[model samples]
Target chain A: MNRRDGDTCSSTPDDSLAREERRLGWTLVAPALGVVLLVAIAPLAWTVWESFHHHDLRMPWLGRSFVGLANYRELLGTPRFWASLAHTAFFAVASVSLELILGLVLALAMQRASRGRALIRATVLVPWALPTVVAALLWRFLFQSDAGVVNAVLIAAGVLDQPVVWLAGTVTAWVPVILADVWKTTPFVALLLLAGLQGIDPTLHESAAIDGAGRWRVLTRITLPLLRPAILVALVFRTLDAIRVFDLIYVLTGGGPGTATEPVALYTFSALMQNLRFGYGAALSVTIFAVAFLLAVIYVRLLGADDGRGGSTT
Target chain B: MDSLAAACRASFLLLVLGACGGGRADPRPVVTISGSAVGDEGAILRRQMDRFMELHPAVRVELRQTPDDASQRHQLYVQWLVARAEDPDVLQLDVVWTPEFAAAGWLSPLDRFAPEAAAFFPATIEANRWDGSLYAMPWFVDVGLLYRRTDLVPEAPVSLEMLPALARAAMAGAGAPGGPPPPAAGWVWQGARYEGLVTVYLEILTAHGGRIMDDSGRVVVDDPPGVDALTFMRDAIRRGVSPREVLTWHEEETRFAFQNGDAVFMRNWPYAAALLADSVRSQVAGRVGVSTIPAARGSGGRPASALGGAQLAINAHSDVPDLAWLLVSFLTAPEQMLERAEAVGQLPPRPALYDDARLAAALPLGVRVAREAVASAVPRPVTPLWSELSERLQIALHSALAGQVEPGPALHTAAADMNALLERSGLRYGMNAP
Candidate 1:
């Protein structure tokens, strides 16, 4: 437009064309970038800002003031935070590991079945299809101390002389929660692993049999090694999902019987929504985001290392 | 050059068209109100709102049914009011929420209306006042009452010690001679870790002459009566007077157990009276009887109960405060209050309404018993920090009942926590000055 100063466009046609392409690319992505900023990045940035202040809605008389790092310092000193962190870690580790093993077993079973293989695969997905809240409620009813069918059957079979209060104890409370989670998500992991199971070539199995390889040898040497990528993917996904568990615990128990099964997410929700302490809740949220971010980085690095080995199948 | 000119003209036309298409305003003003009302209560509210709409044709009133839990309702209001949304013009607040909501400036002051404060119960009016100004209007009154199987126990037990024996006698009489006894629990109340649990603890504590805080805003629960009340609750489970499953029972669960004839006695709010008497839903319809909660032996305290009710408040951000006040006034007027009380067994917000022949004749036992309870019902500590305080009390009480801590130490820990939180903030109940 300012042709009097210099004509850069005429001086280099290639540079002008490249600049036009960059402009078109940014124009195409502007809407997506705007949506991301509005929906995700804006709220995240606001939360980070709020974490540095004392912003409690319920106590508005105590006007919001900048108390940098005070909220984080207070939270770190509180015992409940460390306890909830440990609980979240334990829950994620236990549930993800159980889901992985169970999922692998189910995947193998479905893969081996010659008759009604499709039906078996479809049936395995039924638990995963139900909502997590619904599944948690069902498990809660099943584990009820008095009128639960589980207690009735156990008693009728003489498994115990009396009914056990399944959700009343600290260690026992985690059992039903983990069991419900595993039941709901194991199918997802199985479906992922089943794809890997199918990816193994029939020729490889045939060759192993001709060499007189036993079932154990063929399975360990070929099947598992080929399934490693899928297993890693499923593990990372489920682990992250398990770390942010809130719905199941909220419905089944309100982190109760003396805060026995409270995870960090539930703790943050209680502080933020229930107590209306925005500043403290934001601090807790930032900490959780940091942990999740670190985990994601580690997972990506692991996958990158695996990819460098150059034998990953899809 | 021609293409660029054409593009500019097209963009200008589009902007003009967009501007003209917007700002189509409606002639009628819409007034939206949010509250939580169950089953018949919701229907009644809808009917009343329909009448109000008919009277004022230009004002369209929308009634929003919020979450059933009080804490959830608080969260919903916080979400709306914090964002300064203008849709919900009125809010129904729990009695205990008045202090917190008023202190937060989320509720508009009603001093301009000059409401007839003398028309309502003193305690209900007292609950609506914060910083020397009324922030809400009393909608209805609620107080806990004991429901007993009248066929088995002809007389109301005068003391807490008498309830265990009376419930056991009823259970034994109902049992068959040769086989296992009928499957029934003795006494049931809300034992879940929620706001209801705090109310239950307060009633039990006050029955044994324990106070939560004094007039000067001091923590006063670490006393002998507090420990005794807590120990009594734990003993109720240990002695098999109350079942272990009550640990997970809230209002719904306890209501189910009682209505199904699995419990001999239950402690519940006034709303349960009508629900229990509904023959379609209750097995012990005619047998249900209401009485004031029994007292602690030797302490000589009056029959204690917790004040539980809701109030109506105008949203501070509402654009139509006058219309909102009109709705509140119409809903809480004496005529409407008595109509609700006569129809659904809801206690009127005024003490004078208890003497009405219509209410007395409709439900003689409930009205009489609820009146007595309301006369002496104790209010939980009125403070802006009520939610946090209740959380601590709930955990302490739950831990004590679950056998995780001794009653004495639990009271001490709760008192210490309260003192630390209050002192650290350096703010009193009504003194919100920083």
Candidate 2:
């Protein structure tokens, strides 16, 4: 310290001022860092630690013991675990893609509207505003086999000869689940895209028109290319949310029709809360976290590259 | 502003400390019981607690309201007992949970309390016992029954083979002319993939002479009897004797179908009898009758009803186990059971109660038929791993019913998975015994 101080003696005033500022910044951010460590990092660390143990709350007679990847090994071999992972991936891909396309169309419509735009936007937000569980329940009622409106309408319209048990079929059960997810979250995606649309220069569209670019060409070349960042953001958010989906599917189908629609989060919940296998549940949770984190990292990299190019272009 | 914040914090701390310390000085021992306290159940329980307190004049009993849903309550109790919480000295447990709780050492054995185990139905008593000790007392009993419309069919079907024919005839309006329009479906049961599905399957499985686990604790549900049972259920859905919609129905859904006179036969619990008898809401109000699910033909099997109900047990970590026992015994006594039956239509666990004329009058289903059903009742395998095993079985059964797999293959897979779970948990040996 004395040697460093001697070396910087000539620049002492400025260096000390910089050091003081750095210390003040640290002091200012300490509470937030503490909170992050306490709330987020601590529980995560505990779960990771628990994942290595053999702890079943309902089977305490076995005693909690360190098993060292045994839970993960068991999870890997379990068919139900693999099935649930596939279900999660299928749900995320299916729901997010549908949301993006529908959301993009909705955003374009909203942007082009000149009258009652506020009313249209507000009405579109209603589904998003409703709680996911409530929306899921609403969809469930609509798809019920006997008295559900969907079956009734389909039969009446001659689309079907009779009412189909929507939730009873393994493949058919995913309909309401995906439909509910898309219905509840598309508005948020559209709103994000709408904001992005507003950020685009209207003069760019006018110039494209003067240059003889058709509507489709302008949309494909100018609007879509510029809307890439917003689209990516919405994709990352919705995909992450979709991968960890629980309550909507929980209320709609309960991951049933023989666990056909069970997602990773619901599986973890059953192990943790229902079966009380804390150790196995922790392992399941850690695995889900790892998958979500990997996706996030990929999304962040894409966003970073897009931002750099976007900055250069603008 | 800082001073005011500091004063508020000090006051909050003082308030918490005061509240904690306030209850320490009471001379009378206070015992808390956690259970369903919803609607009439709540009122009856409070009245009983007051009466017990009056009788004792020493120990104070308190009711801690818990979720009415069995699984939710089980989760809450597991959390509390795992934490060794001394309050909620008593717990209301589902029938299948007693063994699990006892094995976990979360329940106090009632052998020391000298409970008269013989008074309760043997199956109910058997369900409450773990490792040669009674861990809980059955407070009430629930047994599955085949509810048929008397006006549609004069008598209950005598056997499983006879059910479809009888149901078809009833659907074709075979009984008296100009009765309620022939029901739309033939039979309905809880076929949803949950615990209720397991219970429904248990009745069928037993009727086909199959057991989930043998007395030696070996998984044998994939055997021929089990396959026959599953096939019978699947065929019901396939043959249109039972509606495919039943694949998504739970107890209440089936009850709704039967209550609306849309089904000729409905399998449900004793709780539905009173609700079905309400003429204002029920179309089959004056037309219902109850019987055990009949034995499958030539299977060497007998009629069986799945055993279910709530059991009361003292928390092993309780500060006042004896007081909790007092509460348990008081609640399970004939008087309280009769009161509960009269008030909420809960079936008493005691076999002798069926002989009581008052019980005959209290239960809308009548004691004789309830007794027969209870007599035929079969408890699900008593093991700490019951919930896990049941979950696997439920999924497998549901998958077969939904046509995702054959009944034989599904049960085989379930059996394999269940056995693996048992072995992995170190319960395949005699580890579960302790």
Candidate 3:
């Protein structure tokens, strides 16, 4: 803000005109700033404040009192909290990586398609159009042990003699969760990448082909380098979403077979809503916000550096 | 534009004033009771509320609908009570929640009303008392029962060891020539990781002479008996007596499996008996039998049933405590309970009603079976930390049953966590104080 003001002052010799412009800018942006403060900053501030207190709705006799960082201390000490954080990181990395890979393949395929391009793109978005909870429930039904279609097909194909209880095992439970997430969100990532793919100059690919470059060589050298920004965008979006996942896993496995698939957001919800431990829940919320913010900042930095390099290369 | 904005603001103020004026026009004392109001439950509650309004013409009784799901309803009630809303004067509490609510000071003590506590079953009344005072009135009782196919088993198992054996034999005998198709599994219960799972574990634990907490409120769920109980449950699945799929089954799923003649033995609540007796929907309609869950052989444990039911209590923040008590007393009255039993198959809390011939005709399982089950009913530990404690136990039980961890280690972890929770909340002292 200071540099922008300095530039305005230096560019314009008239001091009063610059002052008037600054005032007008403030006036024009006041409402939006007020809304951000009200909706975002205020709740975030309140949650941070709450995290330092001791408040349990179920135990009213304990009374609401400021306890410094006692809630945070307890949260950090909790094995479940650490496990949930690990689960969230694992889920975010696994699901987001799968989505990115599958999405890139879909985007490339869509770009190569000549006939019925619009129809193909629209039809590919069918899974993305379905609600997350609905999609998760569909996957759950398909994976059910006794009568699910997954088991039926597997048995028919001589894959197994008996149906496997997917949700009953710790490792097996994550299959449906990650698959549901990827199924529901890969189209979104593909759409983003497809936009980036379209923006790449056709001349670049044409020149590379005239030079006897193979399709794979052209993709690696030109298409992929240009798709960096879009991939980063998809990664940031999917990672943030996967980190805060609740309803999909909630509907499918309920974070169970013993909280084996529980994410930090689900644990925070259990603390806040189910157990009514507002103070500790607020601490969990603040921690998740910090992690997401840190990741976003890192991604934005990478995007900025990539933009600068792309400008020079072009 | 200024004039239009002024006009809208003026009309909004008038609307608010009009609403307040309308509320003031009703001079009668309004009492709202919130509980399940879905389908038949809704119809029965409406009828009862209408009768209540008729008896007390000067007051208005309103039926506010709450979520039918217990956990959702519990969260809603906590939010409401924490905010101290006065409209919902009466609350229908689960038996396990009475202590939690009372300890939180969200429920008004009912001792002042001089309720005939002796008239109800001792265990039912005991569950509602907190700190030597009655806080709620037992409305109806729900006890877990061992449901077996009478045609397959011929008689109830005398011991827990014999139950799975009988189930295995029944499964082998089910597909005889010209008989019913082969049963899929031996036994089924609510093994899902939730409150239902805890109740199921409690029945098994008690049957093996284990208690979650001793009388003095010390955590004893990791004792030898508890280990034996969990091992028995785990081994049943391992031996194929109970299906591995039960790990995902809740009450309804188990009921569906048993009602379809897929299982020879099932464990469930009294509510299932009514649905199971419907020949159109149930494959083994006339062949079902109810018995108390049997004790483990040589464990010196008695046949036990996990106690569960609903209780009526006055909201502590209510404006009309006396009127709320009146409604509570009325609903828990013997006649009303019997009516509820006949209409919905909810077992009356009053032991005296078991002798009534009408209950036998009304309840599909008959009064004798219900009486025996209720007689053996053991309440989950009465503590304000019951929800949290039960959650931990559910995880442990589910982990062991799912083969994620051994029963001993899982239960030990649960006990340690629960004890720490109790200590941190300072409820241990409150619970153990003489």
Q: For each candidate, give its TM-score against the true structure.
A: 0.90, 0.93, 0.93
* Candidate 2, lDDT over the whole model: 0.88
lDDT at B124 for candidate 2?
87
Superposed model 2: Cα runs more than 4 Å off: A1-13, B1-29, B174-176, B428-434
**Candidate 2 residue lDDT tens string, A161-231:** 99999999999999999989989999999999999999999999999999999999999999999999999
The fraction of reference interface contacts (C-alpha pairs within 8 A across chains A and B) present in each candidate is 0.56, 0.78, 0.69
For each candidate, the alpha-carbon lDDT, in order, equals 0.83, 0.88, 0.88
For residues B1-434, what per-residue lDDT tens digits would candidate 2 score against the true structure? 22223335445534643665554666888998878776788899999999999999998887676656566667778778878899689988999999888988888889998999988888888888887888999998889989998887779888899998998887876445665568889999999878998998889988888889886777888999999999999999998999999988878789989998899899999989999999999988888898899998889889999999999999999999988998999999999999999998899988888889899998888888889988888988888888988999999999999999999999999999998888776765443343
Q: Residue B3's C-alpha lDDT in candidate 3?
A: 22
Q: Is the docking of candidate 3 incorrect, acceptable, medium or high quality?
A: acceptable
Residue A191 local lDDT, model 2? 99
lDDT of 3 by residue, B203-299 (tens): 8888888889876677888999999999999999999999999999888889999999899999999999999999999998998999999998888
How would you encode candidate 1's per-residue C-alpha lDDT over B1-434 as one tens digit per residue? 22223335445534644674566476788788887545677777888888888988888887665666667667778888889887588898898998888888888999899999998878888888887889999898888888887766779898988988888887778453463445378899999888888888788888887788866777777788888888988998888888877888877788888888888889898878888888999887888888888788889566888998889999998999999999999889877887777667778888888888877866535567778888888888777778887887887888788777898998898888887877766676556221
Supply DockQ values for each candidate.
0.34, 0.51, 0.44
The CAPRI category of model 2 is medium
